[model samples]
Target: MPMDSVMGRARALWEGLAQVPVSFAPPGGVDVVVSPRSGLCPDGWVGVVALGGSAIVTAPSDGIAVLVRDALRRLPVEAVTDGALVRQVLPVARVLGPAALSYVSPAGFRAVEAGASSVERLSAAHPDMRRLERSAGYEDAGEAALDEITSPAFVVREHDRVIAAAGYRAWPGRTAHISVLTAPEARGRGLARVTGSLAVAHALAVGMLPQWRARRPDSLRVAAALGFEEMGFQLSVEVEGLSPDFSDAG
Candidate 1:
């Protein structure tokens, strides 16, 4: 996708995370989106842009009809209510678990600078990796994913122990998705935010947009504090079991 298109997609994703009603008019048509804070599809709603495409929506039956109509512009559109909307729309879409999408522009990110006296670049060989592996707030897969990262990774330490770490995985176009983990005992100390800021700074320095996805409210709060705008929430469900992806009554 073109850079503008890529940015637009990122913006839409962030708007979804914000869980607010939105109307986006792109080239050919407009997308009427909504992210209901509660009830069905608690994650969010995304409308299909094509004339005969499918949209993944999470709303009451009545609201679904209005959103679908506005989004498809009277075109034949399929409304899928399942949480696994990504997998339904794009078979190749990876299951990323429950997450909220957020993003920060370079200019906006300048306001969230953090200072970490002992932050250091991380590598597979870093001894702190062992501590991160054992931390309850982190997962082995997250540590392993570090190997595939094309952007920067950092860790904050207190003496000899790792307190928090932040990193990003390269994504399509000029965006990089960020991930951060803080030791359970290190919570509320701002280690995650400080380390995360370092990672964001490095990403912006390299001309990459920073994208934040998190399922936890605390994580989302930190992202918001760092100038990341909430776009939407992402939820996934099993694809093998379901009926026709439409419901007028919800």
Candidate 2:
């Protein structure tokens, strides 16, 4: 029921963001928190003011709009719902539980510190990274660009090709978190494990904490194996559609 409502909100948000840029470019925007929805929205959702794509409901706010705000709070990326009735409305997506916001300190963040990295370091990206990309559904964090302002990125390569990657993003007082994804065609090759470990371990070494998502069972395992402790849990709520307002012109 919650998923259904979030699905509807997602559709609505997508419609709102239809003309806006949700995903940030390497050199784009100031930070992840731009104020189209306002407050706490940036920490969870990864897109711009226009709401599109999938979302997670982290908390059950007093109002339904809070679902959208909560979805933007997830570290593991999810669609947490407040109740079953929420889902009854959307009917397109479902509640995928919540993600634990597990983190490792920079002292223990040692995944990438292990060996020679085949991952290329680029400021902006070339078309090659897209080829290395497996799924078009999820977006990627440009480590090369993030490195310019945040943490560095390392990846695995095959046949001189960069196939997988992992890196971190900073949030003011903290050096913050990391993300890793493998090319779908290149699954089961230990690339995610390797990249994940390196990314978290390095974060620990730098006095920064390594916080990744424990959304799926495998996510918990991979992050835990790298010394990331389970910080707790994060809830997500997705809205398939909502009546997004856009009448202001200030």
Candidate 3:
């Protein structure tokens, strides 16, 4: 996978979340591709394009920096309530739940998306699903993927169950990060393999390529099986706190 592909997927991931009605989604900020497209911001935006990474991006005539300036100008997070956590905390802003699990699907992977339809499929037999059941992320959430799978043109299921899982964050363009584990019982049965293939197919159908992180050979095999090529090693760049640069970031 080329870096561009990974970054594009990252943008798609964030955009997908942001596209929902503010009243129906998480409180995270939108994805921004900035620049010098050069030095990255240490703080991550939409899980793509870390501010200070060594990407060596050349600022084009319409470099991402301009887009950042324009977007921030319009959003004016300053005008919005200054919540330390999410981008907007104003009483007027739509209240959304904290999010867990991020995954992307190929444009037409409806079959894969469909596979996760039944939350019940996650029964006691599924290992990953079972683990998810215990996770702080999904406690009582009741099949988080149920909503995402049902919504967004895509769907992700745990084995046959629809478990909302966030994954495969393609930081800047195409490489994605996936860290979802199903109930311990669901492991080894190859549910993730099937679902991941579906996602890769869907992404490819729409020209959004997919790739597996080479670090984990097993996971990489899943991607490779779905036509995903290795793109070399990957690095994780997260934006947790407000970097000093954005004392105004709050």
Candidate 4:
């Protein structure tokens, strides 16, 4: 299938701009491709898509792509893009499936809308750090926000407690993946959008493209408010359970 037909417009834009290679699988063998391009694996992951007797695989290196190609052989074609099955096979991988939505901001674009005036940049030493740690959204985020607190994090304070927050998980290359959190009691208050705007502004200021991934409609709404355009869904498989290090594979 054409890359545009399979990956959608937004993905094609950046992927084309990055000049990443696109390959079609041959019969009885894996497509086996590796690219360091940030757009292909924005979250530092590898992705494989198997459908209709063809497979498309992307990895940081040829060795990993080969490993994923081999693994894909043991699975049904449907499993190639199945985030759940891929995760089971590669427990260390992060998988994104059709259920996930990917969004990206245009170059030279900054959030023009204003966020909450009460927003404050946060750090590990912030007094509300302890409370933020206990929030449902933070826990659901895999506690990445805690590690990223030293990075560009913004939050909204309510009575000396942080009620919502947003920050970047990692800045790999020129792409920065953003994560947002809002306390359960603070939901529906637009705090996420407010703090998220601050995070996006910070990313743009530093010359990094902001990326947003949302698994729910509510989160998508927040991204839309920040002027993020939906690109496509991403499915990735972790390299866990395999040899801890596959970097040197020949």
Superior candidate under lDDT, 1 versus 4: 4
Task: Return the top candidate by lDDT.
Answer: 4
lDDT of 1 by residue, 179-224 (tens): 7777787789887778788888888888888888776689888898
By TM-score, who's the top model here? 4
Q: Which residues of candidate 4, in runs, are more than 4 Å off? A: 1-31, 34-46, 49-103, 106-117, 124-127, 143-146, 238-250
CA lDDT for candidate 3: 0.34
Rank by TM-score, highest first: 4, 1, 2, 3
Better by TM-score, candidate 2 or 1: 1
Candidate 3 wrongly placed segments (more than 4 Å): 1-181, 213-215, 236-250
Model 4 C-alpha lDDT per residue in residues 1-250, reported as the tens digit of each score: 2323423433433344233566444533445566656354554467554333454567766667666766666776545666766666555544555434444444423363434448767774565755776776544556335455435568778888887778885444455678788888888877877878888777767766676766678888888777776644546655764442366655
> In model 2, which regions exceed 4 Å deviation?
1-39, 42-97, 106-120, 124-126, 134-149, 238-250
Model 4 weakest lDDT span, ten residues long: 1-10
Candidate 1 residue pairs that clash: 14-230, 14-231, 15-231, 16-231, 16-232, 17-231, 17-232, 18-230, 18-231
TM match of model 1 to true structure: 0.59
**Can you give the TM-score per candidate against the true fold?**
0.59, 0.52, 0.35, 0.60
Q: What are the lDDT scores of the predictions, listed in order?
A: 0.56, 0.44, 0.34, 0.61
> Candidate 1's error at 119, in angstroms?
1.3
Stronger candidate by lDDT (1 vs 3): 1
> What lDDT is obtained when candidate 4 is compared to the true structure?
0.61
